[model samples]
Target: MTKPPKTAQTAGGETHQSAEDLGVDALTTNHGVPISDNQNSLKSGTRGPTLLEDFVLREKIFHFDHERIPERIVHARGSGAHGVFEATDDISDLSKAAVFTKGEKTEVFVRFSTVAGGAGSVDTPRDVRGFAVKFYTREGNWDLVGNNIPVFFIQDALKFPDLVHAVKMEADRGYPQAGSAHDTFWDWASLMPETTHMLMWAMSDRTLPRSFRTMEGFGVHTFKLVNAAGKASFVKFHWKPRLGLQSTIWDEALKLQAADNDYHRRDLFEAIDTGDYPQWDLGIQVFDEAFANAQPYDVLDATKLIPEDDVPVRLIGTLTLNRNVDNFFAETEQVAFLPSNIPPGIDFSNDPLLQGRLFSYLDTQNSRLGTTNFHQIPINAPRCPFGNFQRDGKMQTKVPKGRANYEPNSLADHGEDGGPRESPAIGFSTVNAATGTDESGDKLRVRSESFSDHYSQARLFYRSQTEAEQAHIASSFVFELSKVGLLEQVPGRMVSNLLNVDEDLAKRVAAGLNIPLPMKAPAAKEPIDMEPSDALSIHKNMKATLEGRAVGVLITDGTDADELAAIVEKVRKAKGKAVIVAPKVGGAKLSDGTQQKADGQLAGTPSQIFDAVGIILSEDGCAAMLKEGAAVEFVMNAFGHLKAIGANDAAQPLLDKAGVVPDDGVTGLDSKFVKAAAQRFYAREPSVRTLA
Candidate 1:
């Protein structure tokens, strides 16, 4: 009989078994072969692309792909748009891809999605957003799949399955749709310290974007760019929004979820329909091996990021989403994007997380589309001519023309068209000279020593934010940890991990939870303090402009027509949108004896949906609105959310009744109102609410 494995206790007093205790009953493959190192995948060298012969990796990912049928396992709820990417700068020396040629335009499709949600989940959840772009270049297709945040939770692909399993709705009860504030997620996160850095981003306003157009996109892993000279350089991709970065506060976000379930999707479609096309600039941080080696952390680690201060991003192209899809199911639902689909000049790197993604995305498409010929779909097909002799599978749409299906056939000599052949001259080539990768190197599953530091960047990110932002982060942690009810150990375990990131953050959360702070969790490697970078804070980088903002104007019967017109004109002049809200959607009688139209009903269009709000009311009109519950809450919420509120003298009584204290954001319906509408009143936040 086999002896039972010995149990080990964690800092939180949780019992778990170690690999050394497994002895005879060890973890193994389906064939019963013991896995030597389950932490990392098989690589050719210390830092090299994953090897195909790594059957352990293929088996693990293959099973995960078919776990469900039809709907995607992750990023299930998504919104897509058709667009064009035009090269605005010359970077031919850095890359040979035609999509980057100056003055060149390529057709592109982009999809924005929420992670860890089902197809029917709400869009306003505090979750990571997927920003994936598919470019139909002359050289074929290139998919730049990324997220709104720069760093990830895990470093290696082998742990991806575990991370997803923990974060998803718990297996036993199946609750908490599209959210991570649960026991399973916190329990898993407490053990993995590498999730610290991304936790700061996840808890901040970055995940609660004002709209899809207001978020920044990032390629989370390091990639390689090859020039026409065959010289390769490391590169990272960034998509800077033209509208600038903006996010909804936690309270506003909750109210928005209750008001509208499809806020983001509707915003994207309306922006394109109204000819206010959303645009973003494509930027790249180019570097060489020398620069990568000098960094304190490994560039190949997915949990780490190279600060923009180290390598300033250079703008090269612009992408404008100009068209909405004709059919939602045909275009948006069926579109497939694979990270492995890269043009000639753009190539893969040895990043373990990225290497696993190349294989996982292809298999995912196969599972969701339920066919190998999914590329034949119109939305996924290439614009340029493409053909191959290999054919015949599930849902095969193309029919071969001749009997010369076999390659190296003499059919061309017999006056027959031999299908496409390999072209070494104009085809994509993988750099194989004295580069970093080598197929002949030793095969091992050990992780590199450089990939151990996990908390340094987390500290840098927390300290970079403004005081208000820091308070929000601490409050967010308290709210999320409080939801882990009855899992008493999980909350303290998480606070222990936070101690390594910031002592103040840990104390704030501990005090909020009403629990004693525990000692710091064990660290794999001691964290070092790095220079603060201003690029990390959304507050520090926000632009005080109304280029893509929306303002809500409240009007009543006998309201001043001149004041309403002035507000609309001023909002429009600033390139912002003005929406009129009234008691009835049909309209209200104005002072000019005209029945003015209202864009939305006051009860339906709460102040949470707009960036700023205006209140214009007559003496009798204010008395009537004071009796309505929705109207009172509307004004109160706007004030509590720190949004600008413009009111006429007659509306002062209503504001006083709703507890709207005088502040910089509250002004008379004059030039001061328009000027104040451009920014959020962060200074007023401390007075309106208490944070952890």
Candidate 2:
């Protein structure tokens, strides 16, 4: 009487249950017989190609062949990982979403992707990243599908397909894969005045983020959260990088594409493998309906952004990616996400872009998943229990055992119920709202006058950038526009558009293009004047930590062992990585008679791939390195890129050979330069000669 375990009870409420007592048998074939040969498909001949006649073979191969659905038109190239999201703080009052209530630990899957690339495209492309997350909660799965940038190109979802078409490679030529600096994009962007603000972002360093971990994520459209009390609050979701914001120079980004196409992927995998898990703080720009109505622009406009100064961000939780996926196809590729897949407490707004997204995601999945029951895929399946009366679709796995299939059946009266009862009181309920309608219904398909002022935020963004960043932006514009070999078709149109943002920027771009500047900018609602938000500047927000950063260590035949060891130890202590490059790929002999293996040969590893570099040599080794053009260029390129250079007394002649001068970031005996090396050298870039 004192000793019956919970497992001792049977379905009949008897106290004599055992593992061998009663239950369904193990999994079996489709006919409910048994499955023993799942590993091997039956074939007439052992070494022959797969047989088509066998139903088991056909079933497995058909599924495997159709396993790969079409990749997304945008964000085709992606990498993902599995992790756990532990809620550090409680915001139950604001949102009843179980993932963020109290100290709940939710399992999460995150996919990071490039916007304009194919499945086989390079990882370091200059493009916006899709930062989408799936959280498994007790209620259901909550998908926060978002992008790295906060603002979008168009204000309405109606324009999304056209925007994507323009940016994609031209249908006829089929060239310029994963690029936007082509004629079609420029033409469409010049015609669409609303695209002006986002064009600035696309041209800026944000598009050339150094890594996925260092960038921020945003739920580009506004959303709503309903608390337990049924009160709704307007919310804009944000994912702020714990490492702060950082980006690579355009030149460095181009070089990296050739040197290491898998740069970001390798960095992510290694970081997790080394226990340096990437982390981002979850923040929200929460507001009330009153604030949305008081805004100058339409809150539903996807092209607009709520300034951080106007509405402060609330830090509620942190998302740490602590694990990597075991298999890419099983986990990342099969993972399906839709913005419409929200939990009970979370809801969507009337944002046009979001509304369109809700439909587009499902439509795209049909082609990608190849079936209506795509949710049955393990990666996309809900962990919580689910039941429905609907059945008999392609690849149906469940079998309902009952005589009655519909609800409210007479079979239930005979104790043979065939359906589950509905819970209307505890189910999802849409909040009813009424617009000021006169007769027919709520009017649609019209933009409010408040959405017309496009230049104010654009100007604020420009003014907010630091002097170095502003110059980079201007230089980037000049570089991209100059690629438009036809002056009248693209460059002139772009200059005319820039005039609306800033007269001086327009003038400089015109001069660079050798075109006459427009006399005046197109008229705007009010003279664009807004307080500069410091949060908009990436360089200003960048942190001093060198975590996940790399350093190049150059060695020669007579490299000093003590010096190399000390430098490598210091880099490791600062959470930075160091790779040893020797004059030869085989090995390098040290002064202490010790030979160290080279991580890379001088010809293989260029200094452009590292955050900083250090050089050690003997007189003979210096002379040899000077004679080798690759070695000379290694030091020279690092200097030109404004990377911090560390050297010993013997390495002076090599520096002289490379024509490197001792700047503030250059270190000799002291290691103080390590600190400066973490910061990018914006001053030196303008002076460097452009590639001919």
**Residues 1-692, candidate 1, lDDT per residue (tens digit)?**
32334665779999876565755566778666657578899998999999999998998899787654587788999999999999999998999999999999999999999999998998899999999999999989999999999999999999999999988998988978789999999989988888999999999999899999999999998988888888888889999998888998999899999999999999999999999999999999998887887898998898898899989999999999999999887888898999999999988888989999999999999989989999999999999889777689897989888887888778898899877798888788887522454634688989888988889999999999999999999999999999997678999999998998999999999999999999999888999999899999998878788778899999899999998999899999989899999999887899999999999999999999999999999788899999998889889999999999999999998899889999999999887888888889999898889899
Clashing pairs in 2: none
Model 1, residue pairs in steric clash: none
Each model's RMSD to truth, in Å?
A: 17.9, 7.7
Worst 10 residues of 1 by lDDT: 432-441
- How well does candidate 1 score on lDDT at residue 370? 88
TM-score of candidate 2 relative to the true fold: 0.88
lDDT of 2 by residue, 251-358 (tens): 778878888887888778888888989999889888887788788777778878899999988888888899998898877887888998998778877777898999
How many residue pairs clash in each candidate at the backbone level? 0, 0
Q: In candidate 2, which residue ranges exceed 4 Å CA deviation?
A: 1-67, 403-413, 417-426, 432-441, 485-487, 519-524, 689-692
Taken over the whole model, the C-alpha lDDT of each candidate is 0.91, 0.80
Query: What lDDT is reached at residue 463 by model 2?
Result: 85
